[model samples]
Target: MLRFIRLIIYAIFSFAPLASAAQDAQLRRLDTIDDNRGWEAVGRLDVDGRGFCTGALIAPNLVLTAAHCLFDTDSKARIDHEKIEFLAGWRNGRATAYRWIKRAVVHPEYVYDGEVGAERVRNDVALLELHHPIRNTTVRPFDTNTRPREGAAVGVVSYARGRSDAPSLQEICHVMARQQGALVMSCDVDFGSSGAPIFSFVGGEPQIVSVVSAKATVNGQQVALGTQLEVPLEILRAELAAGNGYGSTAAGRVVAGSARRADGAKFIKP
Candidate 1:
């Protein structure tokens, strides 16, 4: 459980000076999105105004994010759908489009048991249906693609803890390993990075191949964990189409507000 630590710490002590310098060079902040026209589809998801996670526009009215974001970390209950908001292309306190969540669907296999493992991470995918579709010409939804092979070049765009106000792009990261429906990548990520999209550049167009679920140590180096989206994403889409995956808001269960571990990162779900 303690084996996976968010890669943010690597900036301070995990790498040799030369390697750290190289990493710093690759991960850059997307301060003003006007300069990063390609990343306007990724946005911040404010969950019930209590916490936030990164998400990306996948369709006119659908947003892709991590399954855990829909539940209260402390209560382990499904958060009220009405409380969630999607700030598309959010940056510097402004958003290209803002909309409320109407319904959400998590992978049927996803369980919020507060565990961290390959299976849990692999199934950590979710989709949100917005009350209104984002038809902005500048903020088009991203296209999804099948998972890339091991050692393939990948990239990530995310907004995390300290950099919560703006998104950052790690334009050059490598898929370090692929095992049991999860991809271990040498990407820099942190607490709020969960649900951020992992992209593969195919035909010079960025396509989402995975979603950040957790961070871990691989061979003594920090790496981000993501769900291989092919199958899980299809299952979630089907569930949503059938109108069966929305979480119940009933009041009987114990509702922990938000589960935060001793480490800065939150607990991995399912």
Candidate 2:
């Protein structure tokens, strides 16, 4: 089968050995207030009004997602940060909190254009600074954890293409393997699922262990891939802290910049 990062969703790559199957939980809709409570931080990222991806708030004003979501699907160019919006706790027809991105940064090692290999997969993460912090009582931002071990059970919450109106949670999926700093899990994912937070409920609280990068097939069984999170997350955080690797926004216009490289980077055109 062909292996390439599909622009709409997955960027396929080779895998290590697949672990024995673990019974994964089915997707459950977080439609009601009770079910969606404590998960309001997970939101849908509408990229330039053209497509959307899943993201979650790591801080009051910081949102984490796949770096690929910030780029143009066809042109392979960085999308204007102004055009991106975070619909927090989006359910039914309305969102609990609507926020705009002020600036954003991707992992320094990430390349928006590529074959989406293991190298890209391991670094496919981005962070966005919201113009306003989400301080809703129901929407609490999540914490991060190091990558789980092989065979560790993980969960995923996301807004996919078909389930764009609300988020769905798959409570149990096993880490199939760890390949060159990338993780292969049995979690269910699809289009618009990129950047979804992969959680590990180690102490009865969901901590983000990884961020969904792509969906792939492993030995005839479907699997999802993610970055290891620790190193990449630290890298992104440092970039944001240093006042670099960001594109700014105001009044529906982007202050020309790039998130990939300090030099020879593609600047967003007005």
Candidate 3:
């Protein structure tokens, strides 16, 4: 079987990776704006009073995020669905509306390793079923076809601990990997940043390529990695299509973006 990159990047910036440019500067700004527009809050047990973990509304009723972000490492237990609510356009603990989670579907093959190790951390994507359909919002979908090239500009949108008011963005790594198993970027993130979305320019549009998963170091340098979205798209299609009179009571427009790099690192088109 063909393999997709497994490392899911996180929001925390570690002291491992050793480290960009003006082109890097502009992309960083775009990521900050997109971060605010796309992020949602996922409340769970492990999270403190301010519920941690972030997700994005990819469909009328489905929210996409990191599987590990919602569960325990050893028990493999899920966060209480009742306590789990999605805050749309979430910022300063508010939203246009909030939707309670009826169910959370973690990828079957997902294995957790107590926030460390390589294998279990690789497959970390999750889908949350909301109780109500989002209103008048253009949900962005992930693009699995294209991957950002080496040295290509990239951006990320996510909610971290200190920066809770809005998602922050910055210029980070270009796509780095020699094969299909892993793609690395240079964005620095932190703990609450888990499940943050990775986006890259494709066709002049920002498309989500993967989700923030874990942070690691290379040659004593810190670097974060994320699981590619393609790993869970097939499973997600099945879950979303399993509709059972939940969500999607109204029609909504759709938008597309990714974490992959654009042709020459240009700001995303509106």
Candidate 4:
């Protein structure tokens, strides 16, 4: 939605006025990951031997993440199979379960910008197909029904800076504003936290309502912008209907010529 977008524009101008380095450090300290519980972690995918980004399982056999976080733009932006892995319920060097990637599916409208770009950051969500279906007990689709109020309490779970075992939790700001496709939250996140899920209670259920989209400052506070889950949920339903699953016959392949940039590609046409 445009709510986060407006915050970004507000940040660009409102935050230029200076503060102290101590304050900056304090702000960064606020960036914490919540306790590892109900949430589980997937792992990092990289090129050659270098680290890339992190992903998390959001369903029985599907891993959800940020499109740009996992895709390489320098060389055609394809989902590199050799680089993907999933470590569910990962904690303290141990994994409750593991799986290899069967296929990767980036959003059809996703666009990656080398730098922060308002519209480009709006379609940052993506999904991956696992070779074998994970049991529903270990991982499951996050409920998509919850909606947060203008000012609400939320938390984030993420594998930051390529660290596999050190997941973190931090208090997050409520919805600053809601845009057509984006919602702004007061949460501290960096480059590696893209695609991380934003959770809040809706109807007494902990559900994911947004995907981390961009890093921005709002009202002099740093927050990760998120794309609302509404449209992405629609896309996921269509995928399920089309039979893209561990046992489905969808083939996990987008039609040869159907690949198109998603709604907010940094360089591609939306």
Compare the candidates by TM-score and give the number of the best one.
Answer: 2
Per-residue lDDT of 148-218 in model 3, one digit per residue for the tens?
A: 55556666766565554445665354544312334455666665667777777667656777677755555
Clash pairs (backbone) in predicted model 1: 73-259, 74-256, 74-257, 74-258, 74-259, 75-255, 75-256
True-vs-predicted CA distance for residue 75, candidate 4, Å: 3.7
Show model 1 residue runs off by greater than 4 Å.
1-25, 247-270
Q: Which segments of model 3 are wrong by more than 4 Å?
A: 1-23, 26-50, 73-76, 114-118, 138-145, 178-180, 239-270
Model 4 C-alpha lDDT per residue in residues 2-80, reported as the tens digit of each score:
4644555564434333222121111222122344445654433332223334566667777777776665555646645
Question: How do these models rank on TM-score, best leading?
Answer: 2, 1, 4, 3
Which ranges in model 4 have alpha carbons more than 4 Å from their true place? 1-35, 41-49, 114-117, 136-141, 162-164, 243-270
TM-score of each: 0.83, 0.88, 0.67, 0.69
- The candidate that achieves the highest lDDT relative to the unseen native structure: 2
Candidate 4 displacement at residue 48 in angstroms: 6.5
Q: Rate residue 121 of model 2 by lDDT.
A: 85
Worst lDDT run of 10 residues, candidate 2, spans: 261-270
What's model 1's TM-score?
Answer: 0.83
Ranking by lDDT: 2, 1, 4, 3
TM-score of 4: 0.69
Native-structure RMSD, model 3? 10.8
TM-score, predicted candidate 2 vs. hidden true structure: 0.88
Predictions in order: lDDT: 0.77, 0.81, 0.52, 0.56
